[model samples]
Target chain A: MRRSAFRRSRGDAPFRLASTGAGVVLLAIMAAIGVFLVVKAIPALQANTSNFLTEKIWNPNAVEPAFGIGALAFGTVLSSFLALVIATPVAIGVALFISHYAPRRLAAVLGYVVDLLAAVPSVVYGLWGVVFLVPFMRGPSEFLNTYFAWIPIFGGDQVVGKSMLTASIVLAIMILPIIAAISREVFLQAPKTQEEAALALGATRWEMIRMSVLPFGRPGVISAAMLGLGRAMGETIAVALILPATFGISFEILGPNGNSIAANIANGFGEATAVGRGALIASGLVLFLITLVVNMAARLVIARRKEFARAA
Target chain B: MTTVQTGIQPISTGRRVKDRIVQMLVYLAFAIAVVPLLSVLWLVVKNGIGRFDLEFLTHSMRNIGARDAGGGAYHAIIGTLEQVLLASLIAVPIGLLTAVYLVEYGPGGRLARWISFFVDVMTGVPSVVSGLFVLAFWVLALGMPFSGFAGAMALSILMMPVVVRSAEEMLRLVPNDLREAAYALGVPKWRTIVKVVLPTAFTGILTGVMLAVARVAGETAPLLLTVFFTDSINNDPFNGPQMGLPLYVFDQAGRPTDTAIDRAWTGALTLILIVMLLNLVARLIAWWRSPAKRGS
Candidate 1:
């Protein structure tokens, strides 16, 4: 009896320890990522001659190493911001379609199809952007240049298909499924009684949704959009392939002039000396910080939503 | 209290017109979103079908120049399979254990809450950042070579949070009654989890694992930093440069030649097939084992 009791008590110890260890290991890895990247980036920052944040040129491999994230950061933020602007409304609309507009039997299937868009590898998107979308974007780009030339973004004389606009479009498509999927879940969670009450009040379908679903799902949509923005900013392969690799900080998005931090890392890594790799890592660190802030804000919104739901 | 209208009432014409317009816009949004998917599929098939044949499947790019038309992604296929398998090996056990800890052992505990939140944070780490992490720590610090194993380390980081999230969801779905019943039989908590809880969640966990695999298998950026591309095959994941399907597509697409572009399309098509197949199979398993379908 004493032996059996002893066995029972000790039996779960190893299993519990193993699992706790796994969790600790995961935490360690996350900490290590930040620590090691900082360690690797310090030397590169010290080697730089010019302002690392403001200089336009990237000549990190030279003896007088001079590089800056000005152009890369500018392009990354610009393209991702443009992508967010273009994708948010469409993503919300698509979410509404899946949650409220589609026939009941078709909604699940349609949602799955949208998710397939996410499943397409980024490299494949890069290929499609280069071979197909780039050429096809020419007419639209030129049209924007002609009609919207008064706008600073479309004022550039050179209208190349491989421009910031095209990269933003690709990023928008890539992030649409992420936003739509989250928003659809939230839209579907809107109180059924509220929806019914709106419809019973002789409100039209769209008005009913606007009154019932939109308000409840606002936080979710915002969080989803932020997540999508984070994704767009970090997107590497597609932008790397689509952009013409120009190093300039300009708002003329229709011109073939753009380079993002992630794209620069991918494009430059092959030929980079040790210092160049460090510089790229430092830029990646900047991207990491940007996305981290965005994601944390998204999580905060979600946490607030949970509290709101509980109060309701 | 005044009674609301008892009869059917028509909404205002203006309201109806606005509703119709918004409805059309919603449908248009869905249609617009789908165009790229259909276009990508159609174009991939159209362009890739010609080169995705026996020679392409069997041969490697070996000595083939960018202008050459007959080269294949066989080498890349080998590297991707090996790296992904290595990644799965590293990620699955730890992810499973972490999920178990979160759902079974430490629900609502301080450590569990912190792990859960950090896992969410980890999910937001960019794939390229994961690559850079491994490049800094494994390759540079530890002085490891550019090998598929190093690439697998990066891919495994990307894979872990995905696995933990899915697995936690699956474990959470396990009814508490099952655990109680095992406990009533004087079974230890560990055995109950091992023999009872795990078996119940097996198919669901498998589905999650497969989905995680599919996600990491397509990762190119991490592989770019860790694997360092090669045109020839390297069967051993622990040594030397390797090629992955996505990297193959990226490399070939970068080349300014028709044949290289064709090869890139074929590589992409192959990758899509592999990823989609995994997804479909995972969904099928989940559907087959779903409690509602089983009427349990």
Candidate 2:
């Protein structure tokens, strides 16, 4: 290694400089995003009459210039959590089917279909959600509100179709392809020998999958879910189009009250005052932080899996 | 051996039933997963194909009334093409270089690890947040007018990480034997990469970059905030507000008129077709240029 280093080519310097500059540019962009958000948000935070974290009212345009992100954060977390709940099992099932059960041709076709679904843009999804899903969900929302009224999330009297439940369902559809694609790749990577051993032990196909495939795919599925959660939390258009924006916080998802940070920023940015824009940026800062944590968690899981693979 | 043959007994009916049920569930899962995708495509095509004519592709919405049934998305298509081209121009090179560094120069270094981590984080940053970043820095701080270039800055942010991630994967797939062969011939390291490694991975890198472009080209949030909408065609991207396909769809949909609603559907169809076409081309390149395809 030392000898090779001593004999380094003269052309190395410029190439190395260019590549390192590119890498540093990525780091600098991330830092710059953080710094600029903070710098711009300072005045918005100071000019506020109420707590930026606790107040529920958004009146950045008023004489007092008061606002808070409590409701938006709640709605964002609640809706994304629900989306993760809805998407994870379905994604796992689809992944398992593709990796293990489907015929070869069918698996290939289904894989392509999922890739197409991912390629379908978010605005298009928002269009479909508003035109079809909003009306389609009205019946179900009413049913849940009527029959499942014992639950707090379904206890609301009003059954607005454009509610948190509706937004979450849209988010679920948006994230499903990503989680399914990642988990399918992971499941397909499970050791063939282990699967054969399980089958040789007279295990049924389901039992064999349970023993050989799912255990290996667990970490991958967790990371996929985290990634999906990140996507759902940051999703803007679909939620903006579907959810009826209300500043009031409500535990009842079946009611007409839900607003994510991204959705709020998109919906309200047009009519905002200068301070309102800053407050929106501050909300975006929160969104950036949330997604950053979720993505880092996913990366940590993937890193651990790599280490485990190396050890094995 | 004859005695061992009797050890094999017929499987229980319960096990058979379980297997059948599991297999059925698998099929059901596939159907559930596919139904929404097909429905979306179906609805878009069914409603949008009416106005997808040459006139729709060539005329701008400059003076047309919202209720008047005759304007098209020509300006939007032009704006989208220019902005996406600018974004690709800015992002692809930086992304490819960063990927080269990660794969070739900074394999296990601390900076490499940090870069990889931040890129992951960047991957999940909301599109609106990227728009906000640019709005604060470029539009407000630097005093640049809202233009397609400003929108390109945000789009580049979103595109770069995607390009880096995919390009890194493609670069890593270039076998070490090729690099070793180049070095054995006394070629410089940089030449080995540019001539041998890059060429070998060129098709895969192209597909990755194309996919990245497709992903960002459909983005509406960044353009909505940065490029602020315009109705007329603007040849200059660096000067004023520009209309993009996604933003055009959004603006049309928000109008309370039937004609505008129809235009929204058509605009969406155009955008989806552009994106899907990019994806299909990428897939075709991957299929045709795969090393295994040559052997087969």
Candidate 3:
């Protein structure tokens, strides 16, 4: 028995160590991403003749090395924010439809179909955006510009189809499935007892959802939207293909003048000189920081929701 | 009328109307979401059919120009397969082991909690950022050349968190009674996990790995930064630049000619087919082997 115990300890010790080592390696890689990007970005930041944060132009390969992330950052945040705004309510509705309204037999298949939207590669989305969405948007762009010209975003006269609004629309589509999937899962998990109680109180279907399901799922949906926002901000190829590459800090989303940090990197990396590469890395660093904060906040909300669930 | 008047009033018509409107909106929302998906699929199939022939599948763009009509994605397909395979090799074992740790050795322990939290954070890292990191550390700092292997490293980083998350869920679903049964039979914990627990969860773990592979196989940004671009075939991923399908589409689509655009569409079709097939197969496996379904 003593010998067998000794053998078991020896065997178990190595397995435990190997598993622990694997976990540690993952943490190490996460740390390395932040550290390496920062280290590489510093030289480019030092070489910049223009302000790195506020200047609008991106001329990083010039002899003077003038570049800035102001325009890229603006477009990234604005486009992602617009995508979130456009996608959230619709996503919630879709979630409710799946979890509450759809027949039980149909719900699983419908949910799977929505998931198929996410399984399509982003590059395909880019191709579709360029070939189909761009041309298709011209009509809507003209309509918005003609009718809603007073709006700052729709004020541009030329409806060049490859505008920030078009990109944001594509982004909204890309992120819709993500938000909807999470929201559906949360809505499905809404307490059966509470739902029954609301219905027994003579509540209509929508009222019952509004009072019980929606309130229960609110935190989950918010975190899901944040996750979607993070995805939208970091999406590279689709936005790169859709937006006409221009740099400016303007809110005219209807104009063909928008750029994002990731898109800029994808578009510029092919011909970037050393300093230019560094500039792109600097912009990527900013993107990384923004996404990290967003993701962390989402995680915090989710953590809190878990605690709240336990308490309730 | 006075006798009919009770303390409680009937539900308002206004609320009923509101409910009906909301229900319609909910259904409309679903229809709206499906429209773009159908459009994208329809357009890809329509445009891609022009160039998705045997010639396009077998040939490569060695000397083909942007206006040329006969280039294919053979090389890009090879590179994508090789890079994704390499990434899986690097990621799956670590991911599986980490998941085992999270589920078996240290559930809710400090180390496990931290690892779990950071895995979520790691999943949010942009593909471009992972690409940039590989470029900075492996290509620039280590003086390694742009190759499929570097791209694989970037892809592995993206794939790891996905693998861990899914595998961890699968591992958690393994019943405690099974573990107890193994322990009662004088089986060691390590042996129980390896011989019993892993075998039972094997299909689920395989499904998760397949899904992760599908996700990373479609990633282009990391490949753009790490693998660089090549037109001709490069079988050895460690030696030189590589072409991938997503990058192929990106490269071809950037050109102005009709032929290039046609090739880009075909490439997109191929990529979508690959990703969608993986997803379908993964879901099938999950459905087929689900414990609940088995019990039923």
* Clash count of each predicted structure: 0, 0, 0
Q: Write the per-residue lDDT of candidate 1 for residues B90-119, one digit (tens) a residue.
A: 999999999999999888799998898788
- A99-131 per-residue lDDT for model 2 (tens digits): 898888888887888778888888888888888
TM-score of 3: 0.97
Question: Which regions of candidate 3 deviate over 4 angstroms?
Answer: A1-8, A307-312, B1-11
Q: What lDDT score is found at residue B125 in candidate 3?
A: 94
Q: Which candidate comes out best when scored by DockQ?
A: 3
By descending DockQ, how would the candidates be arranged? 3, 1, 2
* Cα lDDT of model 3 by residue, B1-296, tens digit: 66557776677899989999999999999999999999999888899999999989998899997577898999999999999999999999999999999999988699999998899889889999999999999988899999999999999999999999888888888899999898878788889999999998999999999999999989999999999999999999999999999999999998999999999999999999999889889989999998788995
Candidate 2 vs candidate 3: which has greater TM-score?
Answer: 3
TM-score to true structure, per model: 0.97, 0.96, 0.97
Give stretches of model 1 more than 4 Å off.
A1-8, A306-312, B1-9
Which candidate would rank higher by DockQ, 2 or 3? 3
lDDT of 1 by residue, A120-221 (tens): 999999999999999999999999999999989999889999999999999999999999998988998899999999988788898899899999999988
- Evaluation by TM-score, superior candidate among 1 and 2: 1
Per-residue lDDT, model 1, residue A119, is 91
User: Candidate 2: which stretches are off by over 4 Å?
Assistant: A1-8, A307-312, B1-6
